[model samples]
Target chain A: MSVMIDTGNYIAAKAAVMARPAVVPAYPITPQTTLVEGIANYVKTGEFKGEYICVESEHSAMAACIGASATGVRTFTGTSSHGLLLMHEMLHWAALARLPIVMCNINRVVGPGWNIWTDENDSISQRDTGWIQFYCSSNQEIFDTVIQSFKLAEHEKVQLPVMISYNAFILSHTSMPVYVPDQKDVDNFIPKRIPKWKLDVDNPITFGNIILPAAYEKVRKDMQDSQEYAKKLIPEISKEWKKQFGRHHGDLLELYKCEDAGYILLSMGAIGAESKVSIDNLRKEGIKIGLARVRCFRPFPREEVLKLGKQADLIVIDRNISVGMEGAVFTEVKAALYNNSDAKAYGFIAGLGGKDVTFGDIEKMCKKVVNGKAKQLEWFGFEGV
Target chain B: MLSKDLVEIVFHGRGGQGSVTAANLFVAAALKDGNKGVQAFPFFGAERRGAPVRAFARISGDEIHLRSEIYTPDIVIVLDESIMDMVDVLKGLKKNGRILINTTKNPKDFDFSKKYDVATVDATSIALKHEILVGGIPVVNTPILGAVPKIFDRVTLKSIQDTVKDKWKGEQGNKNVKATQDAYDGVEVDF
Candidate 1:
């Protein structure tokens, strides 16, 4: 009668994908290993009935998934920092071909010095890769997002790949209580594969062929059109998910107590939860502060952000850096709020290589809001060099 | 709301101290008791040794909804005392939360007695006494778990014993079963 509770993101991910009966193709990568490993264990123990392919590398993993998804079956795979980079070429093709593949990416910092901890560099770097990316802050979001990813990616107007990421080591290894919906409810929420297009042997349609300049522009334009059309479908799917699951996070931009607040703490991934705590503590102290959590990053959610920016001062806290270009997220946030003349936004870079973000750091940031002095681009919890 | 009483327990340690293995063993104990739970580790992208790593276990009677990271851990188990200076392991620990430290040192060595009920055990010595190699299976978590009833009045040693027997099947299972008992027997209190 009630929902089943579970934890450990890997098990939730495995149970979700298996319940959907996906044809999974995965390879082992640190952090991202649990999802594929759990699925393998399920198939090995005869608990789940799905074709779990053990590939050699991240590249082959996505390639196998692309092939499987084109065959008209729901497909799944997972990867991390460099693993995602390795799949970069295939990711573009997967999106261009309009295959609805759902992937779980355990957000890890891409390395130049061989450091492997939690960071948003991997998923953030692929921000413009034509896929619908959703950053989940919790284990439950990781589970629910994967389930919603299928519907969003397979929608008639949006046959694109989707990735749901949570910070590596933070949410990946953090064991918190999570609610898993029943198989019957999930099946009802997402009916058996209603793909927009499939590799129909009888229908005989061509795919991924060479295009000359004359027709190449049209193909590219169509891809752009599909993505633009997806902006509307995202909220539509979120509405459906709420109708079935009773929780709605469908906004391109979700604001927290920003109605009366003068300053807004904007962050993606898991830090948003930490920001909420900071905001709550500050609010109790009689300071009006809020948080805007970005759920859909791919379509940029530019319109939703502009609409929300009408009320408050924005602070963008990014876990990834852009080297000489301010912060990666700061640049994007500024661009999103560029047209809004009434808003002033600040940027912060923090949490690289799995560095822990404590409540103290968040409280300190809130103090800046209380003081009414905000920087253009700053690093949280970092001191003098 | 009749929500499930889900408990989040975290283990902080160096790479080789058996924190992860201990967490898994605890899950096995819980699962053997017919309770559903998840055992997992935070594998830092780099697999090198002696890095400060963490493992987690979530045990509950009902489905959990707050799927966020365990910011406020109900129980904090320290396998290696050296990690205290690197990160704030006690940051969001609940007031009067149980702190299980695997050490020969007294609880006076650490500050903040008001926030925690510190339980010390010479688990490394116990593991060595039982001939569990430092590089081998982490046998300290179970023995430290023996002190659970003392720290928290909810879980019982009998529940843990039944859990170990259910998880570790057969004769080899019996050694671990004895190991659980020996671990409970080995709890050393440091005031």
Candidate 2:
């Protein structure tokens, strides 16, 4: 039965426990601290039969998960902004080792001037680290994605780690009703992780040791191949998950009222949820605007994005900037549609460091696009440069 | 008064006064009353105990899609009476919006703008009477929340009581329930 719960972190922790990961190694960080704390509570109550280890730092957290996954056991961990960046080397190590570990990363601002607010730059920075990334917009989606991630990552054809991320504090601290499935049903949906290769006492095999340049090249190719395979497997898993769970959050991208839209608002994470309300309000005003929410960022969803580009003029709203260039999503999206279609892509940078982005702000952006006044690269809700 | 089906409320209190808990409990009570959508979130930055804090809640009959902080609220609840001395509690409140404060003074004793409907309840005394204290500070959030349903009428006192019972158990739960009942009956409002 589904119960109303406060915060997506608790739902994620509940889903992780339900997945029955054999090892949970995590360190506390704001926004993500409660996720591991909730797991510890489950362990203390004897509800989850797993080894919960409190690591010294975020680097050690991912390192512990990598070590545990090497032993062929299901492993889970959680971290945020600075913590995730701190685990940069191990993130590559876990992915290159082909460990199908699942983690929840709360998208907080990476700070030189200390901040704890929501921003996507933290996870977006790890796009090239060979992890399948899923950005969730709601608490229910967070729960559903965490469970589906285990299935998607553990598939023999796609043995890559998956990072499930959501806007820090926006989804993390917000209270909402989430439909949690029964443990028996979840177990049936997601079976125990059984690795094809593992560290065995008798076998005596070395893992992640020294390799020649040619072998290293082959490993890189294999990792890319697995990611390409995941693009196909993601939708298949979503279909089966919908059939079993009665909920579907699209495959890589979810389209909202885009059937005959002349203009489309493209966004991700919590901003996408706010855009839904903007689209609804705009539609009532007789504006033909729609929203295409990118759910998975790492796999890029290039094909689906190209299809949407063909449908309407794409206005990309990105919360993370690419420093000297425009928004990260904008740069990639513009490239994705460059040779294929003649879609005018307008990029808007907004909500960095967790500035509030509301339906009113989104409505104005869409109206500007509709009125042909949107710049090639504009900042939403920012008065001055 | 706002005519929209959605009702937004802002809770102003000290960091350790349980204002965030009050916002959560209000949403929980609204959910129990069959309100389809409810949300609550706190806004703070490296706050310590006794520091000014804010939290927001939204209750609607439909699913809520907006995740932004509440810029305009239909009601504002002040859990700390001293907050008004430091900050303007009525900054973004809608015209004809309501203000509920935890104070021993009468509603008209404070110099509030004439546009608002002010209400006051002695939640501190009620918390002390119920012994809902943590570290020598009275827990005034529950009593303040109890006065909310009486003013708004969208959520019921019964729902709040039931939610309190569902969240707590035994004597602790019963004490909170009694505090809620007393605050609901004792709150004085002036329009």
Candidate 3:
């Protein structure tokens, strides 16, 4: 492995090129532009011997990926915020088509106010598109997850698209040191994609016609089954990656000192990583609290959340709010433990619209939850009614 | 305030002045000097030419987990001395934190130098001397980086020159390396 000091976007770009995807089609968006630029550089340098399509829009970008993946070629792309929103229709199409297209979606604030910063709503809103999702905290995690997502997506048991999301400016723009394994190591770890089925002119097959409810329900069930299979396969691939590369950013949920703690705080993306600092500080103050940094959001890690609930009460620091209900993660974790564990879960709506959520702010939230002073949910940094 | 183990720095400059590049190169040099955890990021907003822009950098012996913006910096580097009047570059700086500026004036000329450690380097002159110009405007980022190792020892003048070469190549790279060395020898520190 060689140490690379660069931004998350560039690291991810290197990881994607090293993975050796056959086709990379993308459009530029803030925070994600540099990533694509990095790939273009590799292409220019002849390091990446593949097709790089400069599509006009994100919609066309995904369309290009789907078209390329339909022919049984490995495909990759990236988008964020409005760019991701523009590709919404094709996102479902790619997942439903069962095309194993790996995408790195830089999580950014969905704009009504023309703002550009780190936020989760962009990818969080795409949660139900039948794609396996992974949230990363650091530049290394971003690189590793991008490489691993390709392996997971192309697996036979789990032929589903994977969306790897991370906080935009926090991860995309921030330069950090990441150890990039040799191309031989990466190529050995994940071989080129070999789809079980694909379009062949000689083989002549019709695809994606309208189906009746029975067949449609089976297709949906197949997607769900594939997702369930991904949960099991993600850890397996992660383990093999660690065995070869000597690093593991956890499987579904990265537990931080939660074994014997009475309180477990949960968060995802950059906030999840930041929570570790708060956990360390609180532990020094003699608080029996730990952290569960959710790495894989879908395949939900419901079982792990339930297990943590049985071990300790959960405090979720969600970076995305569902507007009316609460944080999407907060609701999901609460649902995971429904009628199972009596351990209550509290939700703190923090970092929405890219508001700063510092370690000190996290400490305050943890103290509120641990002291039994928190209600079911509250907006952090905002006075409640 | 930053922990003793971590070094947080803020870069202040106008757009096209390479504030973000300075932060990135600073951390890259630190990484080459064997620092494990280093991060550099621009202000999370749109950057326009001639607009005041800020970038942040951090150095730690261990992996950095805190992802928040640098609010309390241990060092502040100003790439454009003219920006110091428009922006509060010293905001949230730790007491006695080192402040480096790209200016022709002496370090003691800055009144705040009496209160905090201050360093000055005529980086614009160094950049011009090395013919490091983009659009006929001198690019002070690399030269200013050479002044950094004087105030912060975690990175070195050698690594700074090496990183500059890594980012650029051939004649252009040699010029940046020389500009960096010139600033290294030219910097004046007052503590």
Best by lDDT: 3
TM-score of chain A of each: 0.93, 0.98, 0.99
Q: Put down candidate 2 lDDT per residue, A198-218, tens digits, no spaces.
A: 998889899878999999999
The clash count of every prediction, one per candidate, is 3, 0, 0
lDDT of 3 at B102: 94
lDDT per model vs. reference: 0.71, 0.90, 0.92
Tens digits of per-residue lDDT for model 1, B125-162: 66666555545654565556666556544456777776
Q: RMSD to native for every prediction?
A: 5.1, 1.8, 1.4
lDDT of 2 at A375: 84
- Give per-residue CA lDDT, model 3, range A116-208, as digits (tens): 887788888998999999999999999999999999999998899999998888999899999999999888888888898999899978789
DockQ of 1: 0.22
What is the C-alpha local distance difference test score of candidate 2?
0.90
| TM-score for each predicted model, relative to the true structure | 0.81, 0.97, 0.98
Q: CAPRI verdict on model 2? A: medium
lDDT of 1 by residue, A1-385 (tens): 2333233456456545644656888888877777677777778787667788888898999999998888788888888899999999999989878888888888887878776677888988887778888887766667767887787788777888988887776677665435567777777767788776777988998777787897978866877887778788877777877777777754666678888988777788778766776777778888888878887778777776676678777778788886777666667777878856578777777777777776557667667645765466667766420
**All candidates: interface RMSD:** 6.5, 3.4, 2.0
- Stretches off by above 4 angstroms in model 1 are A1-9, A19-22, A212-215, A248-250, A382-385, B1-17, B21-138, B154-191
RMSD of 2: 1.8
Chain A TM-score from candidate 3: 0.99
